[model samples]
Target: PGVTRDRRYGMVDWPGWRFRIVDTGGLDPSAHGILGAMRTQTLRAVEEADVLVLVVDAAEGLTGVDRDVVALLRRSGKPVVLAVNKVDSAQRESALAEVFALGFEDVFAVSAGHGRGMGELLDRVVELLGPTARATSDADADADSVDADSEQADPTGEKSEVVSSGAAADANEDPVTDLALDGEAGDDDDAADADDHADGDDADNDNGHVAGNATDVDTAAAEAAEIKRFRRPEGPIRIAFVGKPNVGKSSLVNRLLGEDRVLVHDMPGTTRDPIDTPFSVGGKDFVLVDTAGLRRRRSVDTLTEAVAGKMARDQLARCDVAVLVIDAAGGATVEDAKIAGMIEESGRGAILILNKKDKVPKSQINSKIDETKEVLSFLSWAPILLTSAVTGAGVAELPIAAARVFEQASRRISTGEVNRFLEGILADKPPPAGPNGRHVRLYFATQAQICPPTFVFSANHPTAVPVSYRRFLSNQIRQAYGFQGTPIRIVLREHRKKRKSAPPERN
Candidate 1:
């Protein structure tokens, strides 16, 4: 076991076996003081795993940290499988001599990078695991399911707990959110209700015959209930400018906001903490988060940016959309690709902003854009807009694009349209056949939620649909109804079989 600041996962799938094993190295606390936070997060992920496999280095034989990990795992009471790695390279039967001293009954000598001795190691580990491990895994999965459900805003009249939490956090951070969406309508509605009360036909007249207005009262109540769905307040659309250092993120923020809200400097890592500014344009409100430039995790331990980078990612995760501002002259660097991957993984709507457009020559501008797109092929769906934040050229379009992406993200499809669209897709090219030689059938699809409109699909062989087929379906959906600037998730489920009808009430 060794200490790694970032998490990593490995999978072992032995074909013909019904079970799978996910292996993660033991959580050895980071040497850096600030990186100590990772140990807590590591414990959380490890605790959720079905089984814990601690791979020890045979070259190092046994380390003091390895003993600490064993002690910690024992206290956690999680079933720990120890595999002494690098045995073949160590190439001696005596490689695990020190490891054997620890006396874990299920220990085995193996090489993790290669396939040496893994089968025996896994077989013994599986024998140690009883049915209870799977049960515990499912229980943990259910709890996570409940947590995800709780985080969503309910469309009914009840206010979601997340809604209240977001509101409080937003109010504490920026007062401009108060002017965003929630309060703007209530005052007008209350005034109109007051005037209606003042009229002579008021229902408050005690023991009076208000028979003619009874329908109006009922209708108003019904209308109010319907309006509540649309009236629910959403926090200001959070837009984050994310990229490597010295990419003009702060400068872009100032250009759009008409003020130097954050510091600008020629040197790298000038801005250390994330700065947020709330503003509205043409009555559309947004919260702009300008985060510190992120460096590689290994290099960030001593830099003040160590903590800032984490905060930046946290901000990026909560944003409604992200503006990836990269240097046009620099092209897409490795750090830029990492940031783009983060945007996709976060499922945020993105607009790729190629800043410093003025420095690039006119003849090679299109080629540069093409090269950037090729570099970030995974984000090809995201709209790319060229601009120079310094000169304010084409800068005004950022907000308008943000508004459009948000609108598209929040759009919902009717059940009829979804089913109709699915019908055409299936008729054109059916789902591929399963391995059992049975034809896969996509029974139906429905939109379960909006704002990154998620769809749930029912299929006869849900597990058999290949990734290629899913991608084709997603592309077709995009073509039929545009979701250009947003990402949509598809969840699959087994179709419910119709129960055999009681042999008809015949007799």
Candidate 2:
């Protein structure tokens, strides 16, 4: 019943309003262990959300847990929208009567699976959030009006001319509007023409006179462009904290965030869902995702744990960087190695965090790192940091290290630079001969892509090139370019010779 073990956030935009929705774990008053942690997350969501939607299962009817949840929400003094989910048909509408007794006013019978009665529920939510929604819409409209006015009042002071010409061009070029007019069979076209004429009349009344002159318009446009350029936000680098359960992934996240943003428990698998919290360090933005600790697939006993494991693995694909936390005190296990392999396969920038550093004796730190490295040998390129969430040792360096790794992954080398580096390296250690003792001639090298910098080499026999040679080239490239904390891909392509066409035969 407690599938959502953490707060999951999403944004929904309607015609005139936009709002955020938070889905929380099911509530249970008598819950302990993981369920108690879920209750904490849900209550936190209740504290933060503008409005709350309490979904109840119609088939199960009302229960003690539902009543407890209602009481909990009532205590928060926040508006609640009760949704009687799984109410599939009109016959189930009678079941909604039981829910109204627990609620203040608004309640709806909804079939979430079939998408029934959701609109009324959403409408009621929007109604409750009307004031904020109206403000947001008004702000957006004001911004749009400013942009339109800026476009219309250009350097030439031809505001009306620009507006009319642009409108005419749009009317002529828009196929969708034309199809709509055709569907109306000229009735709507007359009204549209009337509206255009009215707009043109209004433009004429303005006499094409704007307050700003050519110089002013140019200056304003430049200022606006500069402002927009400066204000444009860069997408935050998403970093997922993952490892075997109870390795202190959530603890590390909490340490880095300087708050308990994610739940940390002594019990394993405390965090079921990937919790994404936006954080900033030294002016750079990042989304720190604390994921469910992953165990071996066979070890995943419950369906919920299986789903959680899947979700954690899925998070690796979405993140730019992965912070693989291992228990430094316990040493890296085979499970940790498997998780590291997953990150490498996902092609994400990675950082190995040997957390619980405080527990490990300071004398054994280097040995622990070496042992972990031996187990996770595949991730040798990934930087490793020993951190302790409890003592806050090395926690501050996590984001900085992640940022550096991200930059390294996103680094691109020029073709000329690549070729030069290849020339120098090939001379130092030439490619091994093909199986038939034929020489493998290397033509040239170029960077094919970035964000996990990939290099392509053109050769006479691409397939004949050995994996050892590819590894050698990768190592050389990394050494030359300092692709630290990121994996570099090497590809080989055959340099095909051009075949001359024979003269056409005249018959």
Candidate 3:
């Protein structure tokens, strides 16, 4: 096997992330012992990694070999995250069980080929990895104090996890890690510890660390603090419509346009390059991208085909929401699930568009719908829209659905509204009791931020919020406010003000 240095690095132009991504070759013995060697190298990379991303073949469920790989990863003692690839159907949800069987509970079923599941996967990974903690050896801490001078200067002392990619122009430059991953980087216990260490450092300046370096650190910290405040202006929402060949994605696009804008062909994979067409949906301007069909790896024979497929997938990284078009008449296939999984993995909001429903029989259509629900069960919430490109059955509703999903994805609820909503919910049926007899009182709520709307609720005994109640609240939010086809996040925080209770005096 020929050896080549495939390592590349650079800054990702993400608003709140300094992404350092290492693209290593995968190891598949049958394909190439080169893959095996690559796996070894990749594993080493994983050790230095804040996150471990294992991309699986979605079409080929968790096979015996993939299981073996998972087993190996589990034993590695690293934070193992699974990405089930090529899942593009309503029937493929069952295949997820096979992946779960691999012992990775946190599995992301996605279609890398069609840009699915990429977003949430990254979000979770980043959350888990956190701002890359300085590889501070336990030895880095002196006695009871840690030299957290680096952190103190960091006003919002969130461990800066810089995600660098080898794919960029300048790899050596460490792009500034954003201040906070969460909405607000309040100084927590960890930050307090770092602050204490800083105080101790100032008290006993034995080494006399240079004033210039101190200023530089302070400046970097200041910059990091301000970085959190910097908000990139919002732009038009970019949507990518992707699926397997002859799935009516193009047809649907044409239907949406009410004109033959995209080249609609009877043949699969006719549209080689991803075509971008701008259109208005629910009064919101959107750029609809119609990518070439993404087929199975085995099905991809030619180099041109593979390249085109890659280009189609890369488009997912560029999109805010991805519409996965499935052939409803054909029934939800493993292919459709795989594609759905990809959209999910991309972390982009997804609306599973079941097109060509007019052709399918009633019984078959019902069965297909059930299967679609089953396969997409992993999704917290999303709409399965049945449409027909030939006949405008549900095409008009597609844009409205997309816009609604987008709105939900980017929505941030006001604190006042959340508190009022909480009051109403509690009055209807109070939260279950905690370990103590005291009932949990929700103090207030705030928009933690969006792209899958996240809400933070400050309450008494936040940890005691039952899973059932959380689900109930999630549903209520969706029903009252149109969360529609986007995922919603509900975070619980202990209200400090509620903790200090004093009798209210008559004023």
Tens digit of lDDT per residue, candidate 2, span 1-507?
445556565445556655555555667767788767766766666666667777777766777777777787777787777777778777777777887877468887877778888788777877877665443455454321212211111111111110000000011111001111111234453333223222221111112121111222222222222211111124778899999999999888888877666777898888887877777889997888888989998898898899889988999877889999999999989888888989988878999999888898889999999998899898899999988889998999999999999889877665445555765676667777888896776654555455667676666678999999899989888888888888888777655433358999999
lDDT string, candidate 3, 353-408, tens digits: 88988888867877887888887776647788889999989989877777777777
Give candidate 2 regions above 4 Å deviation: 134-234, 498-507
lDDT score, candidate 1: 0.61
Poorly placed runs, candidate 3 (over 4 Å):
1-235, 258-260, 264-267, 280-284, 295-310, 345-347, 362-367, 424-443, 459-469, 493-507
For each candidate in turn, the TM-score is: 0.54, 0.78, 0.47
Evaluated against the true structure, the overall lDDT of model 2 is 0.67
Ranking by lDDT: 2, 1, 3
| Candidate 2 TM-score, C-alpha based | 0.78
lDDT of 1 by residue, 257-354 (tens): 78554556676665555555566888887777788788788777554578678877887766788999889998888788898999888777889999
| True-vs-predicted CA distance for residue 84, candidate 3, Å | 44
Q: lDDT of all the models against the reference?
A: 0.61, 0.67, 0.59
The Cα error of candidate 3 at residue 182, in Å, is 15
Give each prediction's root-mean-square deviation over alpha carbons: 20.5, 19.6, 22.7
Models ranked on TM-score: 2, 1, 3
Local lDDT at 153 for model 3: 12
Higher-scoring candidate on lDDT, 1 or 2: 2
Least lDDT summed over 10 consecutive residues: which range in candidate 3? Answer: 146-155
